[model samples]
Structures are given as C-alpha cells and as structure tokens.
Target: MAEKIIIGITMGDPAGIGPEITVKALSNPAIYDRCSPVVIGDACVMEAALTIVGKENVKIHPVSNVDQCLFTPGIIDVYDMKIVDINKLEYGKVSVMAGDAAFLYVKKVIELALAGEIDGTVTNALNKEAINLAGHHFSGHTEIYAEYTGTKKYTMMLAHDNLRVVHVSTHVSLREACDRVKKGRVLEVIEIANKACLDLGIEKPKIGVAGLNPHSGENGLFGREEIDEIIPAINAAKAEGIIADGPVPPDTLFSKARGGWYDIVVAMYHDQGHIPLKVVGFIYNPMAGKWDAVSGVNITLGLPIVRASVDHGTAFDQAGLGITSELSLVNAIDYAIRLSKSERIK
Candidate 1:
C-alpha cells in the first residue's frame, strides 16, 4: 500500500446527526483529495442523510477493505456495519440499537487500525447515555479507544491551538473524581500530557496541573488534598525532568494556558477540563437554538492506533432537520490525519 492513509470515519449515533454530518462533510471533494476516507457505518442511513441534506449526487461506495477504496470525489466509501433498522430509529430518541451500532462502528475501526487496514480514525459524536443504556458501558470515545486498542496507558488531549488540556479523572462522579486525584494517576497523566505536547511539535512542553480543590486547597486552609496527593504528583513528574507545576488554582491555570504560559493543563475531571475548552471552542446561536461551530478535537494520546474525535456529543435533537454541521467532524478528520502523519514520520 502506498502509505495511502486510509482514514476510517465512524458514523456516530444514527439517531442523532451522525449520518447527516457525515454526508455533509464529504460534500467537499478536498477530503478525498487528502486521504481515502471511508465510513464504518450503515449505507441506508447514509442514503437518508444524503437525501435529507439534498445532495442527491453524493454517492456511497461500499468496500470490504480500504485497499479496494476509490479515492473519488462525490463518492463515500462505507464499510456497511448494518447495525440499524432505520424504521425503528426515532430521529432524536436514544435506542439500544443505535448505542450498540455506535459501539460497533468504533470497535471495528480499532480492529482495522490495528490490522493496518486503516491508517487512522476520525470518530463522530456518540451518546454516552445511549451506549450505557445499551449496556456497552463506556464513558466516551477515549475510553473505548483505549480499551479496544489494548492501550494500557492513554490520556485524553483536548486541543485548539495553544489552549490544550489533558485530564486525570474523567467519567467518574464528582466525589470519586476528587478521590482519584492521587499522586500516581496525576503523575501518569502529567507525563502523558507532556508526551502529547511533544507530539504537537513542542520540544520541551510546560504543563500546569490543576488542583483538585479550590485555591489549591488554600494551603490546607480549606482542604489537605493538595498537601496529600497533588503536590506529591507534581514533585514526582518534576523529579523525572517534566516541567510540571501546579496544585495551582484551577481558575488561574486555564488563563495561564490561554496566555501561553504553559503548553497544556491537566484537569482533575471531565467537566473541569471540558468547560473551559468548550467555552473557547463552541460557538452558539441562541436565536437558532443551536451551536453553530466547534473548533477543538479530542485526541486519545497514548493509543497504539491514532484516534481523534469531535469534542461534542450526538445532537439527537437536530437529527434530520438538515441543518447539522460537519465542521467538527471535518476538524476531527483533519486532526486524525495530522496525528497519523506525525506518527508516520516518527
């Protein structure tokens, strides 16, 4: 194969806007120009999406493997997972079928990546609640990729230019998230973030780890977590020559990252990191009652196989209204391609 970067794009929750966005995204001939893009999803659903979006000329190419792909414009190469009964999929409703199918799309992409069938993967948004409801029980795409790819060590890297962040605890309850801010996990994630920064072409990255408590436990005035777990973690990472600092106030560390003081920040939990990133990335339109744009890609840092995703969830409410935006999906594909390129060069 000619280092032919076969990019596998998983169509997310069919009940949501996954099909719509996948269709809309490939309307660009340039996506095919950069890489031979394939969709690990349903053909009938994509057909509906194309019709809904009114791009009747856009055609779907079903392939058994990426090697058989035609890198042609106006045509999408889809590996038919055949997991949905489109009649049963209520546009905006969560279904076990949708959840299971979403899980399969992701799972197959990993298998193909490991088997060298695809060079990289760009995942669309999947509904966590739906996945769990179907008993697939993953927190999100990061965990799913980490587990299936047999990546024992991995970190979630959220990036948009210099406003990058990695998390120590994601997908846990608030109290559990607080408890998980131990030295070992903290140090692990710090190292992961550092490596990720290097992957982003930063030679020597500066990382600021956010404290688990307010005012970094206020120097034991408010809490002792900083004294007990966080501080030790920072010491460990620094001891090994990682430019890690923090137990800094969470409120201030983000501003520092935004101001270019640090290459990235390590957040304690999912929302802690995600909130600031979305605030910077997601563009909302109140009048239209929609998010008009999203600018960040969620990269799984320690995976053996390359995976990146839209930093948004399944827009179940906007399923086939024909206004779903593929900008985020397109961004995810671009980032996946870039990461794959970086890894290939190494």
Candidate 2:
C-alpha cells in the first residue's frame, strides 16, 4: 500500500479561529486516512484549541521536524514553533505576537515544502492587518507563497465543488484593478486557469473570461476594456489551442460557470471573483444567528509547492466559541492531497 501524503497545515493567527478549526478538522479520523497532517504552529495554542473545540481525547504530539511525526489518527503532531504567548493571546483581537507567529508558521511550512519534507501545505486564515502589524508586510498568503517559493506568474483560484474562478488581478483597489486589466495579464490568467483545470483532471477545460465592464462593455458602449483588452486575450488563448470563451458580461458569466457551462471562469479582479464564489460557499442561518457552513478552497496556481487554504477569514467574533466551521479546512486538505498526488504523477 502507498504511504499517505504528508500535509503540513499552518495554524494561522493564534488569536483567530485557526487553532480551533485546526484541532476540529484533525479530530476527524478520515483525514488521517488520506494524509499525515502536521500543524506548524505553537503546540500550546493547539493544546488550548483541542479543549476549546471539545476534542480533548485527541492528543497533541509535538515534533521538531517531519521525520518525528507519528502520523496517526487521534494524535495531531505539531511542528511546534512555540512562539505564541498563550497568556497574552485573546480570541478575535489582533496582537503583534500572534501576527509574528502566524507569519513564521507560514514561512516554516513553505520552507518544509521547498525542502521536500512535506507533500503539500494547507493554511488556516490569517489576519492581514495583524501580519502587517508584525512587520511581515505581506499582502496575503498568495503573495507570501509566491515570494518564498520564487514563483513569478501565479494567480489565486477559489473553488467550491465544480465551480472555480481565477483572478487576473487580486488584492488591488477597484481603480487599480481596472487599470491592471490588459491583454497580456488577461491572457496570462487564462493560460493559468486552463492549466489549473487540467490539473484537476478536467479534460479539454472550457475557460470563461470575464469582462471588466458591465455587459462586457456593451460592445464598446459601456466601456472599451472588453474590446481593448479582454477579447484579445481570449483570442490569444484560442491561438494556443485553449478552449477559452468570453469577455462574457460579468453579471451573467458566473451564473453560467455555476451551471457547469465552464470549467473555470477567469475573473478580471479580486472582488469580481470573490463575491460570486463566496455567495455560493458561505451559508448563514438567520434564525440561529450563525453560519451553517463556510466551505470553499483557495488555491494558489503556478507555485512550486502545492498550497490550499480555507476561503473564510479568522472569524474573530466566533473564534473562542469553537463554532466556526472546519468544513473549509477539510476541503482545503482534500485539495492539497489531490494536488500533491497530481504532482507525484507528473
């Protein structure tokens, strides 16, 4: 029998729901069947999380390196950083200690992956503001991965089941997002999107490219971005024998993608892609006054190492309550495993 893939999971900001969800997700014996999951963060934080999430039966095994991991169910091996101060830590609030710990955790996981100590990595959500306060200065995990791995051309891919969307430009202002749209960048994203689908075992993936302007610029009526940039990129993708479609109107493109018309949609920018993906993935129960499920996977395509993350944030309000959903983390581990196996095949 083949060995289970080794997946390194970064316990995100110590003050957030990261540790809570990490313990909850690891409590599932099914996950151990697929991957040797290891948490790269403070063992003390994880210990507290196990109790908070009511998984006290599960043990926290601290390992300084990958070879030390037992890789067994009911035993979550933490590659302990021991950086977070449990006494100083407060659920939901931002702190420099937590921020620096979060940054270091991510950095260590990337280092482990680059060194081939792990097959893939899954990340819990980290607070951007907190990380910056710690002086890491990274915009997000994608940027951190790109920098540490020396990947130049990469895009964020968010997936909920069969629905997937890749951004041409993410983490930029609306004005900058519009200005960032160009034939070259759009084509680059389309190419990446096509390859991403192929990686997911989609044969002859149909790529749907979205327009910057509404109604896809109404054929130059609403805006010329469609004619000037997006359409040309689609045509260029076609030239490369990629089954690329649209400059489809932003309003309707996602609906078609969700209905299985396209394998993946190439969004023009950050919110353009995030809004629709979240609309489908994030479910809130009004009567219960809590989320029923927050399920989605955020993948970084074109990275040297496989990385997938929970689509939701730290959920500061719900952190210590142990009510934040671990479904997204479960989904992320599944993706990381699949992507790692795919890499092994390659």
Candidate 3:
C-alpha cells in the first residue's frame, strides 16, 4: 500500500468549535488509513476540547516538529504552538488572544506545507471578527494564505456533493463585487476554476460562468456586464482551449450546475456562490433547535501549496455544547488528500 499523506490541520479559534471538531474527526481510526493527520495548535486547548467532547480514547501527543509525530491511530500528534493561555479562554466568546492563537496556527501549518514537511493543509473554522480584532486585518483564511504565499491571483471554490462553485470576488461588499467583475478578473477566475477541477480529477472541466445581472442583462435590457465583460471572458477562455460556457443567468446557473450540467460554476460574487452551497450543505432541524449536519469543503485555487477548509464558520453558539459536526472537516481532509496526491503526480 502507498504511504498515507501527512495532512497538517490548523485548529481554528481556540475558543470556538475548532478544537472540539478536530478531536472528534481524529477519533475515527479509518482516517489513519487514508492520511497521517496532525493538529497545529495548542496542546492544552485540544486537551480541554477532548474533555468537553468526552473523547477519552484519543491521546494528544505533543510534538515540536513534524518528525516527532508517531502517526498512530489512537494518538493525535499535535505540533504545539502554545500561543494561548488555556485559563483565559472561554468557549463561545471571541477575543484577541484566541484570534492571535488561531492566526499563528494557520501560519505555522502553511509554513510546514511550503517547507515540504507536510503534504497539504486543512483548516478548521476561524472567527473573522476575532482575527481582525487581533489586528491580523485579513478578511479570511483565503486572503491570509494568498498574501503569505505571494499568490497574486487566487479564487475560493466551495464544493458540496456534485455542486461546485468558484467565486470571482469574495470578501468584498456587494457593490464592490459588481464593480470588480471585469473581463480580466472574470477570465482569471475561470482559468483558476478549470485548473482546480483538473486537480480534483476532472480531465476537462465544464465551466459555467454566472452573470452579474438578471437574465444575463436580458440582452442589455437589465445590464451590459454580460455583453461587455462576461461574454468576452468566456470567448477568451474558449480560445485558450478551456471548456467554458457562461454568462448564464445567476438564477439558473446553480440549478444547472447542481444537476451536473457543469463541473464548476464561476460565480460573480460572494453571496452569489455561498448562498447556494450553504442551502444544500447546511441542514437544520427546527424541532431539534440545532444543526444536524454542516457539510462542504472550501478549496483555495492558484496557490503554490494545497489548502482545503471547512465551509462553515466558528459556531460560537454551539462551541462548548459539543454538537458541532465534524463532517465538513472530514470532507476537507479528503479534498486535501486528493489534491496532494495530484500535486505529487504532477
């Protein structure tokens, strides 16, 4: 059998559900069969989470470096960053200390991946407000990874089952999102989306580009973005031998993509892509009064190293309750493994 890939997982906000879900996900022995997983966070934080979740069999093996990891099934090897004081942290609350700790964990994991110490990186949910509060001043993980890796062009791709969507403009206001939808940016994202699909095992990805306006501007009746920017981008992508079809109406694009009409959809903005993915990935039971499942993986495209993250955020309300789902983290790990394997082959 081939050796398992080493996946470095960043424990998100220490006060959030990140440690809880990381412990829960690593508890399953089958994960060891696929990859050697390591937690890049404070060992004390993970210990608290294990106590909260009541996962006793799993042991936290603190390590100073990757080579110190045992890769054992029941033992979770944690590269202890020790950036936070466990006594000061309170679950379900956002603070600068927690934010700084989370940021440090992610930075360390990225450094490991780039240094060839780890095959890929998987991130748990981090609170944006808390991170900003700590003066990191980045919008989210994608932005941080891009800046740290010196990647000039990158896009966020979210996947759930067969539905895949990539964004042209994320972490921007709605008005700014529309303004950023020019031919150059749109085409750049399309290229990234195509390459991302190929990395995920698609030989020739079918691309669907959503329009910024209604009915793709109704032939210039609603807006001219399709006629002016989107169509030209699609034509240029085709000219470059990319299998792309777009300027599709935003209303219909997702439905078609969900039905497997396209391998991926190039969404015009953040909400345009996120709303649909969350609709299908997030499951809430009204009577249960909590989420039954949250399943999706967020992949960053056009980077030197591989990164896959949970689609959900830090559920402050459900932090210490131990009800946060590990399904998304598991999916993100699966994606990281696939992408890492593809990168190795290339």
Candidate 4:
C-alpha cells in the first residue's frame, strides 16, 4: 500500500454527540488500516466518550503535528484544541463555551489543511445556534470553510452510495432562497457539481437539475424561475462541453440519479436534496427513539482544502446517549481519505 493518508477529524459541539461519534468511529480497527486519523478538539470530552463506548483500551496519543502521528491501529492521535471545560459541560444543553470550542476546532482544522499540515478533514456535527451564541456568526460549515479559505466559488455536496447532490443555495430562508435563484448561480452550481464528479474519478459527469417549482413551472405557469433561470443555466453548462441537462421535476430527478442515469442531481435548495439522502441514511428504531444506522457524508467543493462532514447534525437530545451512531463519522473519514488520495495524485 502507499503511504498512509493523514486525516484531521474535528470534534464538534461538546454539548452534543460530536465527541461520542468521534470516539466510536475511531474505535473500529479497519479505520486505522485505511488511514492515519487525528482528533482536533478537547481531550476531556473525548475521554468521556471513550469511557461510555467501552473502548478503554484505545489510547489517545497527544501529538504536536500530523507528522508526529504514529499511524498505529490502537492509537488515536489527538492535537488537543483545549477550549472546553469538562466540569461545566452538561449533556444536551447548548452553551457558549461548547460553541466556542467547536468553532475553534473547525477553524484550526481549516488552517491545518490549508497549510498542508494534514491531507484532509472530517468534521462531526456542530450546532448552528450554539455557534452563533459564541458570536461566530455564520450560516454553516460550508460558509465557514469558504470564508477562511477565501474561496469564492463553493458548493455543498451530500453523498450516499452512488447518489450525490449539490445545492445552489443552502442555509437561507425560503423567500430569499427562491429570489436568489438565477441563471448565473444555477450555472455556477452545475459547474461545481461537474468539476466535483471529475475529481471523484468520473470521466464525464452527467448532472440533472431539480426544478424550483411544480412540474418545472409548467411552461411558466406556476413559476418562471425554471424557464428564465434554470433552463438558461443548463444551456450554458452544455455550451462549456459539460454533460448537463434538466430543470427536471424536483420529485423525480433524484430517482433518475439514484438509478445511475446521472452522476449527480443539483438541488435548488436544502431540503429538496437533504430529504432524499436522509431517506437512505437516517434509519431510526422507534422502540427506543434513536437512529440505528446513521450514514452519509457531506463534502464542501471548491475550497483550498478538502473538508468532509458527517451528514447529520448536533443531536442535542442524544448528547450523552450511547445510542448515537458512529457510522456517519466513519464514512466521513473514509471520504477524507479518498479525497486526500485524489489530491496527492494531482
């Protein structure tokens, strides 16, 4: 095998399942076999998770840099962010301290990836409300990565198996999000999805765009956004030699992508894309009111550094609950390794 890939994993909000998932994900021996992973957050919180998950044998090796990591099977290297108070941390409660720590970890991870300190990043879930409480005003992770890396063109790509979708505008209100949909932004998103597919080893990515309204505006009957904005963007992308087409029905486009007819589906908004990915990822057992198998990964495209995240949020209700699934976190790390390997090849 080639040299091991170094992936920096970020521990998100201490008030949530971030710590738990991070610990449980790394507990798998296969993870170490694939890549060298490091945690970039509070040691106290991770210790608590380790104890809860019954992985007392796993050791957290404190290291100063990625190069110092041992890359061993039983050791999880940690570059402590040290921005939390374990004593004051209460599970399932939103606090500014937790938010501040999460923000710092994310910031530090971005810096490390940009500086070539690590190959790529995989982040656990962080609460947006808590992040704002700490006065780090931002929409979400995609924006944070974009801002710190000075990346003007960026998009959120959510993936599960062969199904992948990228949103044009995420983390915006319904009214404004609809208004923001124009030919330029639509074309930009199409290009982003296309380029992302190429990086993922797709020779020619075929993208299908989801409509903003019912039946793609029924020829401007319900809405003209499709006729005026979406279709124009699709044409522009095709002109650039991109295999792009649609303004397809929002409800049916994903079905086509899932069938492997298209490489990815470009969603107009957040829920339109997220709902479908979750349909396959978010599997919960109602008997205990907890997810049994949480899986998927969110990759931010067009950034200076590669950043992937668990396709879930800060489960405030399941903060200390042993029920939190570590599957998503593991999938995120796997993606980070794949992305890192691709980068190295380039």
Candidate 5:
C-alpha cells in the first residue's frame, strides 16, 4: 500500500464553526485510510467540538509536535497550539481572542508545510472581521498564504465536482477589480487556471475566459476591455500553445463550463466566479432552517506548497450547534491529498 499523505488542518476562528466541522469531518475512519490528519489548534476547543458532535469514539490526542501524532483512525492527533482559552470563547460571536488564535494556527501550519513537516495544508473557515480586529490586517486566507509562502503570483480556484473557476482578482472593490483586469493580469490568471487544472489531473485544460463587459463588449460598443485587454490576452495565451478561448459573454460562460464545455472558467473578478460556484455548492433547506450541504474546495495556485480550503465562511450563527455540515471540509481534505500526491509524482 502507498504511504498515507500527512495533512495539516488549521482550526479556524474558535467562535465559528471551524472546530465543529473539523471534528465532524475527522470522525469518519475513511479519512485516515487516505491520509494522516492533524489539527493545529487549541486542544480544549477540539475537545468541546468532539462533545458537541457526539463523537465519543474519537479521542483528541494532543501532541507537541507532528512526530508525536499517532495517525490512528479513531483518534484526532492535534498539534496543540494552546492559543485559545475555551472559557473565554463564546459561540456565535466574534472576539479578538478567537481571531488571534486562528491566525496563529494558520501561521504555524504554513511554517510546517514550508519545512516539509506536512505534505499539504487544509484550512477551515476563519472570520475576516475577527482577524482584522486582532490586528492581522489581511484580506483572507489566500493573502495570508501568499505572504507567508513568499508567493507573488497566485490565484484562487474554486472547485465543485468538475465545474472549476479561477479569479482574476478577489477581495477588491468592484471598481478596483475592474481596473485590475488588464491583458497582463488576465493572461496571468489564464495561465494559472490552466496549471491549476493540470494539478487537478487535467492533461490539457480547456479554459474559457469571461469577458468584463456585456456581450464581450459587442466588438467595442459597450466597452473596450474585451478588444483592448481580454482578447489580447487570449491571443497571447494561444500563442503560447495553451488551449484557451474566450472573452466569452459572462452570461453564458458559466453554463457552458458547467456543462463540461470548458475544463475551467477564467472569471474577470471575484463575484463572477464565486457566485456560480457557490450557487452549485451551497445547499439550503428553508423548511429545516439549516444548510443541507456546503460542498466546494478552494485551491490556491502558483504556490510552492499545496493548500486547499473550504469554500465557505465562518458560520458564526451555527457555531457550537453541532449541526453544521462537514462536506466542504471533507472536500477540501480530498483536494489537499490529490494536489499533494500529484506534486510528489512530479
């Protein structure tokens, strides 16, 4: 049998659903069959999560280092950072304490990945407002990973089953996002999207680039971005022998991509990409007053280390409720393992 991939999972905001989902996802023995998983967070938080999820069979084994992890199916080996005081943390609320703890956990995991101590890292949801309140002023996980890993050129790829999308710009104002969509940046993201598909096992990725304007500028009637920037980039990409096409109309791009017409869609901005992916991944049950499933993986491309994250946020409303679904976290772990294994083979 092949050796199991060791995945480092960062416990996100203590006040959020991070702990609950982490514990629930790890309860399945099948996870251990694929990889040796370790949680990098407060031991007390994980213990509370275990209780909340009623996973009595699973024990939280606190380890000071990764080497001490047991990698057992019924046990959750945690590299306890001991950053949060469970007594001070409140469910369904944001606090600086939780934010600081979440930041520290992510920082530690990134350090471990850089040192080759972990094959790849999987992140739970962290609260952006809380993190900023704690003084770690960054946009989100993608920025944090890029900064700590010294990665200058990186893009966020959201995947749900076969429908995948990559952003040209994320976490920026719409105006700023629009301004940032130049040929250089558009072409850069297209290349990253292609490479991301390869990492996900696509031999020759067919990429569809979304236009920034209506009707792809209708040949420069509505906007000049397509003629001046987007199309130029597509031409540049084709010249480089990449199987890319578009400045496709945004209205129809996602439908085609979802139907397998393209391996990946190069969204001009964040919402253009995220909305379609989320619509498919997020499942809500109004009658039940809860989410039935939150299933998607967010992969960071053009980084030295492999990282996959849940394509959802810190559901503070559901924290400590034990009702949150772990599907997204599970998917994230699967992506981490696939990306890590692919990296090893290359």
Candidate 6:
C-alpha cells in the first residue's frame, strides 16, 4: 500500500459552480483513499455549497496549514481564505470580489505546492473576464503556472481517455497562432509531448503532429507552413529517435488519433486542438435539456509542480442549479494524483 498523495484543490469563482462541484466531488469516499484533498477557498462558500449540493452531512473544517487537515472522507478540510461575503454572493453573476478571491486561491495553492506543502494541485473553473476585472492579467491557468514556477517552455495538454492533445501555441489569436508555429517551437512541443507521454508510462510513444493549414498546406498550395516549418520539425524529432508522425491532414488527424493510431497529437494552435477534444469530451442531451456529461483534464506540461484542471469553464448559467457534472473535476484529481505519484517516484 502507498501513502495517500496530498492534493490542494483551488475553489474557482464563487459566483460559479466551483463550490458546488467541490462538495459534490468530495462526497466520494474513494477520493480520500487515494489523496488527502483540501479546498483553498472561503469556508462560508463551501458551507453553503454543502447545502446546495445536498451534502450537508459533510462538514467543512478550516485549517490554516496542511498539517492541520484531518484528511477524513466525510469532513471537507478547507484552507479557508475567509474572503467571500456569503450575504452578497449571488450565483450566475460575476463580481470583482469573487474574481479576486478566485485569483488569490490559485496563488495560495501555487505557493503551497512550491513550498512542498502539497504533492499536486487541481483547480476548478474560474471566470476569465472576472479575473481580468479584478486586475490579475493571466490568460489562463497554464500561463499563471508558468509565470509562478519560472518555467520558460510549457504547453497545455488536454486529455479525455486515450485521445490526448498537446498544443504548440495556446491562448493566442488565430493569426498569431499560425505565426508562432515555427520549427523551433514545434520541435520544443514535440519534445515536451514525448516526455509527457513517457512520464505517463507510455513506452515508445507515437506522436502525431497536426499541420497549420488544410491538407497539410496541400504541398505548399494552400500554405507553405507545413513545407517550411512543420516538416522540418517532424524530421528533427524523428532524427532524435522520437516516434513522431505527420503534418497529417488536420481534418483526419483527430479521427486517426481517436482510432488509436497515435498516442498523442501535437496541435498547431489552440482551437485546432481544443475543438476536437471538446467535441469528444463535452456531451449534451437535447432531450433532457441538460448536459449528460462534461469530461476532460487540462494538464500543464514542463512545470516544476503538478497541476491539472477541469476542462470546462465556470458554468455561470448552471451555477447554483447543482446539476453540473463532477466528471471532469474527478478526472482532473485522478490525473494530478497520477502525475504527482510519478514525479515522486522519479
């Protein structure tokens, strides 16, 4: 038997589904079997969440330090920021207070992980607009982690089961994303993707690199990016003994990846990678008039500490309804534990 990994979970925007899902996920007894989880958010929000999610029996225990956590299943130990004003808090609306608190919670978790207080960190969804309104100018969690950890080369990896995709350039304009796809960055991402797969215990990982233009630039007809940049990167990766394939047609790359032809796909840009992943991970039931499931894990590769996040955003429309899926968050926690355990072994 192994010791449980300590995972710090950042509660996202209070105006969203963060608190509700945190309580819902914690109610699972199996989670405690693998990790000692703590919520870094307002205790009041969590208390109210317990009621909203109908998990009132689960107590919210506030602890100033990780050492103080009981790590018990039914008791949700929270490193309470004591921030949110429960009376003023309203679901489905963004406020500066919620935004600031969300940003601060992430900051504290990052600090703790850097200090070796926790093995890994898992974050719920936070509103980008709200955070920007609150004055923290981060693009997303990946950017925040890279800046905090002082990591120069890091990429976002989104996973839903076996179909994993890593981006060459994320959180950038379409034109900029195309411009950013040079041989150097492409090669860097390939190397990172190879290392990530290896870390995940995949032996001799098969990587499929997607092209920037249609039909891999149609032999320089549609564009010269594949001929000028992408091919050189693939050749460079192959020379280094990495089993990387493509400038596969962007249209068919995902289908082949999903068919198990490749262990991972290196996407040229954000939407190129995200659209396919989401198409597979996010499911909605029109008949039921609700989401059947939202599943995926967002991982930041090449960071000093382990970090994973739910693939979905702060669902403002479904905030207090308490009907949001915890599948993504649960998967994120599992990924964090796996990554942390692997890091520890190394």
Instruction: Give the runs in model 2 whose Cα sits over 4 Å from its true position.
Output: none
Model 1 clash pairs are none
Q: Kindly list the per-residue Cα lDDT of model 6 for residues 129-204, writing each as its tens digit.
A: 8898999999888888998899999999999999999999999899899999999999999999999999899999
Q: Write the per-residue lDDT of candidate 3 for residues 224-296, one digit (tens) a residue.
A: 9999999999999999999999789999999999898999999999999999999999999999888888999
Off by over 4 Å in 6: none
In order, candidate lDDTs are 0.86, 0.93, 0.93, 0.88, 0.92, 0.94
Write the residue-wise lDDT of candidate 1 on 52-153 in tens digits.
899999898887777777778898888888889888878888889999899999999999999987889989888888899989988899888878877887
Best by lDDT: 6
Better structure of 1 and 2 per TM-score: 2
Q: Candidate 3: which stretches are off by over 4 Å? A: none
Find the 10 residues in a row with the least total lDDT in model 4: 62-71
Q: After superposition, how far is residue 162 of candidate 3 from its true place, in Å?
A: 0.7
What global local distance difference test value does model 2 have?
0.93
Give the higher-TM-score candidate: 1 or 4.
4
State the TM-score for model 3. Answer: 0.98
Off by over 4 Å in 5: none
Query: Model 2, residue 162: what's the lDDT?
Result: 83
Candidate 1, RMSD to the unseen true structure? 1.7
